[model samples]
Target: MLQIRKILLRGAGLEDALVQFYSGANVLAGESDTGKSFLLECINFILGAEKLTLVDEAKPYTHLAVEFVNSNDETITLVRPTSGGKVAAYHVPIADISGSGQSIAPTRKGKSKGPDVTSVLLPFAGIKEARLRRNVEGETQRFTIRTIESLFLVDEVAVIDQQSPVTGKATFGDTAQKRALSYILTGVDDESVAAGEKNEIVKARLKAKLELVNEMLQPLNERFASPGELTVLTDDTELDTLIGSLTGELENLATTRDAIQERSQEATRNILKADSQLLGIRELLSRYRLLDERYTSDLDRLDFISEGSFYFDALQEVPCPVCDQIMAPGHSHGPDSTALPIRESAVAEAAKIHAHRTDLAAAIRDLEVRLGSVEGEKHTIDTELKSLNTELSRTLAPRLEFTTERLEQLVNRHTEREATRVERERWQELVKLQNDINSSLAESGTPKQIWAGIPPKELGEFCAEIQAVLSEWKWKGTPHVEFDEKTFDITVDGKPRQSHGKGVRAVLYAALVIGLLRYAAKNHRPHPGLIVIDSPLTSYKKKKNQTVKGENGQIDAGVEAAFWKSLAKTSKDIQVIVIENKEPPTEMAAEVHYQWFAGEEAKADERAGFIPTKSAPAN
Candidate 1:
């Protein structure tokens, strides 16, 4: 049994009354206006109910308080002053389950610790960030408990002696209604993939940026702008080290160019000097050769002229000494003697001079010919040297320049790569940091502190379980429940309707409660502090038994009485307080006995004056 220590009532139109109450089901039976409901209202006031309704003529309660003992025998009293409203409740701590003060604040006491009332009330408020978001998204709806009470309460289920409002456009017979029940039964504070999506987006953006930077950093030919094609490559060594090799190559080219130019210049100068020397030698040699040819011809002519002179001057002459007998002269002499005395010194000197001149001319001619050959050879050498110099300048110089140009390009390209490397490193680091920051991102993109206490996955499972129970009822459509960080969404047949029919809504409402309890049980979670069901058997379908019977059958009760019985059976683990106008199910109410009497203390309705207890309906 759920233990109840005492009940305190003040200004409920009653001056004096009992100071305690019986636990379990406390049935208040009295006259219609004799504080029967006030007793129940008193329980709600201390229970943190926000909405309070009373007749204008009837008086209001000044104060209401209740005491409850826990399993550890510690007592706590929840009190609410009428002026402060039901939401404003104060607590009183006691030593034991009995009415005795002990601790100052029971909830704050360290002994027999439980969850903070804030955490407990956090779910109860249903004003969490998730719920608010859902409400804005138009999923289920936005509501506070106070507003919920204005629409439906246990009083509507206990309709007797009068008919009540069947349904309204925005009544409890809507998807929002079922969700309200879900919230009441189980508090689902948070459930939405907020941080997950944000993290992914951040990662994607980082990757894109890193790729773009890497591509631009690459060498000209291998570069790419497209993010898909760009790939970032990393190397341990820096480009600065490679500069030495290029410098070495440039040095070699410069050296070779200098050496070739020097050799070419030397060859040119040598050829020019040799030509001048040969030219002088050739001039002297030409003069000598001409002299030699003239000398030789003159000698030959002199020999031939001597022979002719002998023939003309000397005629058949023998010896001049024996010419005494013969009168003929051996040789006719014209003004000259045959045996004349010669000028010996003049002849000898002329002969020596002639020989010396002839020899000198021959030697000069030989030297001139040799000098001419040498000069021609020098010309050939000069031409070869000039051609070689031209070849070096035309072919090798351009090649050297080409090498220079290529080296410059290589240097420039490498310089670009170096700069790119530095910048790319920054981008790479940013990408890594972005990844880390995004990893710490929350599930719903909100701060973890706000929703960390909520088990969104479990709440989803609870909704699914409720959907399972609702499957039995044939609604206009299938009913579904969805809760996110913002709000809850309920659908019938996978589609949203403005509202649901009375009978369908009632099924949804029950399913919601069953789902919550089932979830808690399956997960072995703590559930509501208390549950009160008034007329749990009340339904809104058209009465089948009230209609005429068909040809072959009577009627099929849409809801089997066994379902409620099963419900009561399963709800045993929780503190379920039920009051039924009709008999409760056999499974749950089997052992519970209810005694009835028609006497002065019997509960009465407004029509009691017109109808007596014996004439009243069985209910």
Candidate 2:
């Protein structure tokens, strides 16, 4: 088992950033963008990555050093340049690296006239002179440390990607990944497999077929970035159901919008009706007012006639001379002309006009009341129309728009599934062609199987180890884990690991790595004995006002705690380094090597982050 002890990064005129690890379990928890990922990259670089990923915070740093103890308990420290170059291995610790150390090339192909890092580290992990078959022709290549790195060093992206935890991202590397795992589990290498020779014609035909298959598979592989996509293409029931559900929701939203629109239209119509009646009432009131004025004028004229006749009748006869006489007091002014009778008739006419005026005034008052009531009704209708319009625009319309968008997404997914189905068929054809090539090669010569599958008893034991790991972590389901040889991945409860959500995938991937370590330790199998995981608990952390649920439809309240406790109880023979953003449970603080990057300037014993913001105090 290779246990990491300490890592240091320093440059001239800059503060040295240092992190130390312990034997059992180590955790580096911090905020994001604070060089936690950079630290992982630095480790990979030291292990044998051709290039170190450059980050802005690490720009000033030029050298990195990692100290670890191999399975033999021999302390070894390796120092390499961050700018890329050969690595210097010191049989002693990092503090003594300046004395005497072996200079090893960073890569296997480097012309540095020194041993490569792979050759040096392989023996340290109890693996020496291992080889893996590169192709179906049984041609072998040296299995370097990089071949097994993914199993133990899981980064953030790899932890949640839908690819097999063993198979990694590259489709072409699937065979290599499987062979690497087999080598670890079974203590076997592919060097004993014999390479086959083919005649020129056979080789030419095989080459053509291989090229054709690769040409067809390239686009399919690129289109389906992950195996999960191909899995999705196999069944359309879930997608179809989702599409149906979205369609139903969209229809329901449309119905609601239509209903609101209908109500709005009705309110508008009622408003218009009330407005028309109000207008009619107003016009009628105007005409009635005019008639009332005419009645008043008639009454005034009648009054004047009545008063003038009364005064004339009251006049006494003065002179009887010719026409000047006052008609001799009711004598021959006209036929029986008495001013009293005229006055009485005029007064009666005035009273009739007055009564008509009173009736007209009452009618005007009634019309005014009706006009007010109609106006009130119009106002009420207008208010209702405004409210309906608001609801249609603000509530129903937005909801309808959202549902339409969701339905469109489902439709697009359905279309993508169709395209994937075609690609899947093409992939099948490619597989058949490859199998035919393999058959032709087999018929030509007897080639030893490069990698016989893992023994069933061993595989069963490995699966049980994984189940135990998950059980210890308080995994949501009754985990029945099986290593799927067909997919080169694990299945939990008969479901492929990729089928679960990303959080579950991450947790399951973590379990696989840890379980492998535990299994190797228990069975005395060869393993690196060191595991570094990043962000394994990110999706398990509860955010503000949110309750996180796992795959079993239960709140994951205890999963994170269980994860920490399990790691804390990991065997002392193995070293587990977990990089996370959330804090661990307080109870397990004493059990694990807790390295906290406070993500701020240090106060007292706290750290700022993986990248120091200031120089360390002189001792």
Candidate 3:
């Protein structure tokens, strides 16, 4: 499913070398001193690793270049080492790669036409060809790859053999070199990226993440997450806690408010009591004023009578209407009262008595009026105070309590989401781990037949299948090569172990990767369709670690190899490229197109090692 059209290199084992490859399997082989490994480096270079390589004779300043063609007829050219006296790069038309009649001409600064090239022949190289598009004359055009495109390349043997300081078995596959492929996906420029850049990148990414987290929490702070996001029980508990804290303060406030209201009511009650007393005093005052007014009116009448009494001067008994007729004396009788000689003193005394009575009437009326007004004002004040007390006690006070409750509810909602997020994240992780374990078991030769009654998601059933597989294992005498689900452990025979020997471990690892891939594929997860392996097999480095070769272990390897062959055959969509000096299963090899690079054509660093490039065992 994957093909290598060609690879080109400069200044490695060879000053200038290029190789063309078509589909099938290709092998590069050479004796220890030849350029086999150097050619491999060249492949890595052309694919996209950008390290300025130490080439033939250690020409550290040498430039590098590469080219490739894809199945879609797209040609890619790459060149690099441009700076530091290396000035590199140039591109050509696709027609040139197609071997057509058209030729490419180099343009100066601004040009109308551009070239096309984007693929990487290998994954790690020092050259790059990045495609850039520009709008010229209102027309869309694409630029050529001025740098190498990264492709997959493996140099395990050379890596393990290196004695260099930086060559301690890499924790990661050639980092700077592998960056070519990463660039395509991440748009990162290799030259711009430094070893220390990851820390900064991660920090920046985290900063952005934190900002988003803050924003999300801000809205959820208002209890605004969706139904799935907001957990009811969790929310309620959180609400309860928040409410509890606020309720204490609210309760204290309630006490203060109640006391204030009580004082206000008592003031009103006192005012009412004072008003009642004042009302009585006011009634008395009103009667006094009325009596005073009446006294003035009666005094005016008495004054008129006294003036007439002085002018009369007739003898008494002149008009005795009820006594006798024509009686003439110094006395006058009127309205059944007898009057003697008119006297100023008597008139004055009568006026005084009349004024006294009138004054009493006026005072009584004034008191009555004052009392009426006091009663009305007291009634009004009582009503206003009642309204005030009712509003404070019932409306505003209750509203404050309601507001407190709502605030607590909101706080609780946010806390619930925080907890839910933690729980869901953990739950998802556990599920993923459990699934990974089950998947590993399945790939470790645990058969579907043993797990036939179990569904795919049933991890417990899968674990049972694992136990069953172990119990039925043909090579059960050793200790912990088999896995245990109960303890999340592994054992070989009767001995407990976490990992196994290289040969078995390699198979196990392969099983692990494969099983995971299968599980993902079945569950509709995304997976790449290609795998590249370099020096995939080696004789056991430790003799004591070897399992009996003639036993079921050998048989299992055969079956596993067969399984790979079948997978390769059936899953034509996937491509598997494995490099090894050891012979593969003949049956599997027969189904693959294979080639071997012999003589001076193996790795890219061979020529750079200063060995005579021409002095190799000729095929």
Candidate 4:
């Protein structure tokens, strides 16, 4: 563990100032614009961070030194020119860094040499300038200081990020972040595993392959677990059962479909027969009307014949117009006159005609009765045909369509079963590979659990510690907070830390940083064992026109105080440095070392700032 003892700022033009820090909680409390954040920047510069923004007052300072004890309990002093250039290291005491030192330029990556800070500092933490295998393809990357710097310093931007403390920013890739975290948790660099025996190297290779496979499988598993997707996974037996059920359903639907088709055909045939029959009936009715008209005419003719027969009987004599002489009364020989038939013969002919008329009327009534019967039958058939058409349109169509859709669903289910089968096989192969590696390690008498990348149990424990700390801080959420593996962040009541306001984001960020430190120390994991945070409690200060009100936006007084109190308690095992504008709470005053910078006041010691203010005229 790397623990800072003192940070000193000195230059030819400016007065020398040294700030000493304890292993426990340290508070740099003061008003804004007083160079409190400048100390973090100085620490970063001393630790080989790229560039330093030179504030106007800091421009006068030319050199800065950070004295810290390495993991080996050896005190080392890191000295760098404040103008931001190469670093100089000294093996001597912190008080003697000004005397003799070896100068070394910081390497961006790879093996450090001479006075490079990584070369001297990493050695104490049991790391050499190591080449880490970045991918399963055997590509390598050299460890650098930038990879591990976040483990110690949580800058102003990082303090309010509401994400993982180890996450890389715009310039740093996530792979580097992962490497940094792995280094801290395992304490095993590429150098440690590179020197393994042949069999051990083979086992390591197998383990690496297994890890890669797992990494590939993680998202796939999440996809399987995603919402609005099928939940059941089918094995061969289950698939067979499902297929059997689907087949049975399809067969039944097919039978019903066939029945419907047959019924429709039957109805169509019946409708055609009915239409043909109706047409025949209409033709028969038309013929019946014609016959009725003929019968009526015959009846009228017969009645006229019967009436004329009586008139003929009245003409008993005939006259000859040519001679103007009447012939015998019983005999008529002229064309205009006829002799009357005997009275009996006339009566017989009239009776015959009257009988024919009665017969014709009866025939007309019989034709009318037949026409009425045919029309009634046609009406009944038309009603039946209409009903059959309605059934086809309203009932059978939708049923058939629904059945077709169900068939499609079954086909999709079968496809999914095949895909599930493939996924399962791959998963099983990966499991076997892991088991073989574990067995090999056991046979070789090597500890299987030794420094294997952060296990779920450890992450769970870390999450529990965070929850505990938040509880102590009186955080406004359920006690069921957990770590989000995908995002490498924390969630409160199932909401991500980013969903919170800026103030809560800062608080959660502090909790995560401090919680990880405590977790590392408790587990005896490799870590720098120091957390330097800037403005973690900024939300607690009331600002002008403060309107935002949410977990991350607003400040809770009790929770804020509790945050410091929890830090005070955890500081016993890990060193924590907090930079805040607000004064330390009375409850935590005894536990934390307070350095108050009151740049607004006139006094020198109590009211001056991190950088010395201009001297006033003696009055």
Candidate 5:
């Protein structure tokens, strides 16, 4: 429960401005354009905000002091450079300022060394070092005090239009937003709930393997009549049954393949033999044809000789040489006695040549018939081999090959399934360990509902309190305000806050912030124990001679009076500072602490604005 006790802004050239607050409600009311909003800016700057802003008059200020009380009732003064530099903290009072103290540099969270604003203030607020998930799947980051600041401070613009009180102008993502709320409501962080050994690395590896297993199972499922049957096949016995069936099918296929291979080999050998024999017969036929041609030529010559011999025998006489006398039968010019023997031998030689020509013609005809028979036998063998090869390709070979491939696929799937089984067992072991850790947490005095965070029942009760606050303020048209779970915005009379005008939106936003404070204080939730609101009642102002209407219709005349009266009663336990343009009602003025800034037109000694003039400063 860290609560601001006091804040001071001092400068060398400008007058010292001071504001002191109590545990209850404090109102600072004044005219337009006064430095009322500037106080909120200074408070945030002293905290760990990255940017700082100041009004024109307060620009001369170079240092700010924030004194806050921790849960142990110890006051720590945080002194920081107003122009944005390193911050120094003191356990002593801000009044006893020294030249040095513990230095805590200003930097973005998660980028600094040991001692910073969060490390200093978180112990004061009774929160342990913790982390919040940035997203469902993203990494977790350490929680900073800046996350808790939204509940403690509400600036002018935020008091008018923003929806969730936990949300800041800068995005902290949705999971972080919820985690921050849960941390404040219940003193639990992501580290407390997250199982230790079941780290992200293990979970990620398991997830990848599970995805691979599921992908492989999809195709296997399609092979079955009902794909859903695969769900029951995780056991080893079930897998082995399928494996055995596939093996039997593959064995049958192997037998048929072996037979076809043997027949193809035998046919191939016969084709080679026929080809070799045909080559030898072609060589013999070529030599025989050449020999028969020579024989036929010899026979033709012999026939001509035989015909010449017959003519020679017919011409038995010869003519005289000089006196034109007829020659005797043996007319010889020389060697007259050898003529008769030569003529007789010529007749016998012609007869023998004719017989030899007849025998050569018969042998040529027999050789032609033998060559034709050998060519026909080669053609028959070639056709038989072609038929055998076509049968093997078209039927038996394809059937055998398909069965073998299918059997291989089934065997590989079984091996993969066994590997998947091991991974699944490891994953289950991790899950069991995680569950045991959670159970131990519950047994060790953590609330059963803490693991799941603040339940809907608690949220509904909180919303009921907000509804009661709105009703007490006399809101228009039976205003049924409830927290929407999805968008984390308020639904006014069953309509979202965004559907309302700015004035109405302002009033609803104020209720939500105040309601959180009231609920946290009453329920003993982990809160900063302080809420500072600026311009909470925008609808009550008299703008351009017309009062701004909110909610159902024009705001009732007594709404402002009721609003402050409710705060006065409800804010008694916590410190709440409200800044607005309109003053509090006359009847309820004494019930609340009030300040009025009359602007620069007043006498020099009187309180004209937040910054004092030359006269004096208020205590």
Candidate 6:
């Protein structure tokens, strides 16, 4: 397995920024504009990309070096100048990569007579010298490391693209990509295929093909009113800016609407609570009124009794009717009879009733006061709710509607812009095709070739591997994945891969790369055994205009967790590097090598980015 061990960027006055990798999984995640993408680009450059994309931050770096372990477990370090030159290979670690070492030409046509980078690296992947047919006339080109680089290194732009994961935006490279995949899967190449017929017959055929390609290009060229319009369509920056602005406006409107709705809900709850309290108070008041009526009746009866007792007391001691004997007032007539109370007892009972009635009156008054307060509170709540509803319906809702409509219009415009881009790419492809045909006609002889396609069984197994990867990632429906040889791409549940949204496309593309690695390992095929992917989980990040959905039409909440878990369990034979803006699931922290480009140096230990904030002299 080929594993990247470390990378170092050195300059005369800048610190040597260092990044390390392991055999299983390595993740570099953090804020944007922190050199994640630039790091990937640097890796590509060291792996023989023709040009190194330089940013302002990288201006001070003069040389790039990569240290990796080849399949044979031999450590190799390659150092190349940022300004472009031959790559120096050291059969040692980066610390010892300086001074004289074997010099390898960066390209096949380099001025140096030394071996090229492709020839040196191909053997590291266990692949022998190979050639692929580049045209119908059997014109072949040497299979180089660049041919298979796309399978291992997927950048941000290609990850979310609608194009085939194995292919690039340039249609001219499609055939080479297909043939390279076939070579990897079937261990077959077009080296032994028969050459085409030569002389007049070949020339005539080439002429006809050239004519056909020009015929296809005419309409595409005329699709735009002017060449300048087509040129503008080539760049996506303007359209992206417009879409981003519109999405921001829509998000603001939605946020405002949500705030209003939440306030309105709170107000409604308050009103309901006040209404409940008001009802309780009214019930209490009714009971208090009944108690007050009883108090009044008791007081009147007590007063009547008191007056009658006084008259009785004044009548002096009269004999009991049954005994017919003189008896003292307030005394009993017999053993079973009790003494009757005079006016004093009646007055005491009236006093007790009056006290209770006074307390009851106070309680009733308190309840009435509370009832009025609750009613007022309810009224206030009702008024506030009405205002909130009006604001939502009149102000925020209408604004939201307008913003949504504008967003839709911008999205439609973006779609149109993308279509124009595709047409322009198609036109470029046709022109290249025409050139290829003309070149074929100009050649003295041309060869016809018949290259074998990937065996069906192998293709099926490859697809199954992809399905298993997706299943492990908790993909919705565990959709059936099939390799479509016609399009040289995979299909999910009979649907073309490109038919899905960008988020799905990004994930599916990652699955493709990982599946290739697993399949190669299982089947004992040739592979680089290292995959470097950028922004595979970008769709899952909470970004504007990004919506990650599953086949069931709902957002798959488990996908991110499952993705991290699955990668954490990757075999030791492969090395996977992922650069993202979001952190991995916390549970997998111990399983993978993780780094954070915090984007700011808040702490002494925290890394600011790939480019150090301070400069140091190169050793």
TM-scores of all candidate predictions against the true structure: 0.35, 0.57, 0.32, 0.55, 0.55, 0.57
Model 1 segments more than 4 A misplaced: 1-8, 11-44, 47-51, 55-61, 69-74, 83-460, 467-500, 524-527, 533-536, 539-560, 585-619
Rate residue 499 of model 1 by lDDT. Answer: 45
**Collision pairs in model 2:** none
- TM-score, structure 5 vs. true: 0.55
RMSD to native for every prediction? 35.4, 23.7, 26.4, 26.3, 30.3, 20.4
Clashing pairs in 5: none
Residues 1-619, model 5: lDDT tens digits: 6677778888987767787776677888877666777778878888877777666666677888888886577888888877788789898777877878899965454555668887787677765677886654445777776766666788766655445666655364756776777665555667644432334454454455445645554554454325454354586776677678767877776776677578667766766776676676567667656766765676566556545544543653556554445555454442244444555565566566556646645655665665566557656756765765676677767876886787678778877877666555544444444454445444633312213435556777777877988889887657677677666667878988767766667677777777877777788776777888887675444433743333433345666778888878855567778888788887666777877776755565556766666422221
Better structure of 5 and 6 per lDDT? 6
Pairs with steric clashes in candidate 6:
137-447, 195-448, 196-447, 196-448
Per-candidate local distance difference test? 0.45, 0.79, 0.42, 0.68, 0.67, 0.79
On residues 1-619, what C-alpha lDDT tens digit does candidate 3 reach at each position? 1334444444544544444444434433233334344545554543334443444433533444444333344445545441222222333422243332222222213654432122222222222433321111112222122221112333443212211111123343233322222233233333322122243454454355445555545544454335654454443575566667777767776777787688677868867786768866865676666666766676677677656665444445454666766555432444223333344565767767776776676666666777677777777777778777887878768867786877677667766777776665555444444444344334533211111111223333322333433333333342234434323233445443223433443333333233333333333322222334444344223223533221112224553454335433423333344544454565655566543434355465343222334545221
Q: Candidate 1: give its CA RMSD in angstroms.
A: 35.4
TM-score of 6: 0.57
Candidate 5 C-alpha error for residue 592, in Å = 1.4
- Model 2 accuracy (lDDT, Cα): 0.79
Instruction: Please give me the total number of clashing residue pairs in predicted model 3.
Output: 95
Worst 10 residues of 3 by lDDT: 447-456
Give the better candidate number (4 or 6) by lDDT: 6
User: What's model 2's TM-score?
Assistant: 0.57
Model 3: CA > 4 A from native: 1-3, 9-18, 23-36, 47-65, 79-152, 157-498, 504-531, 539-560, 563-576, 585-587, 597-614, 617-619
Instruction: Judging by lDDT, tell me the better candidate of 1 and 4.
Output: 4
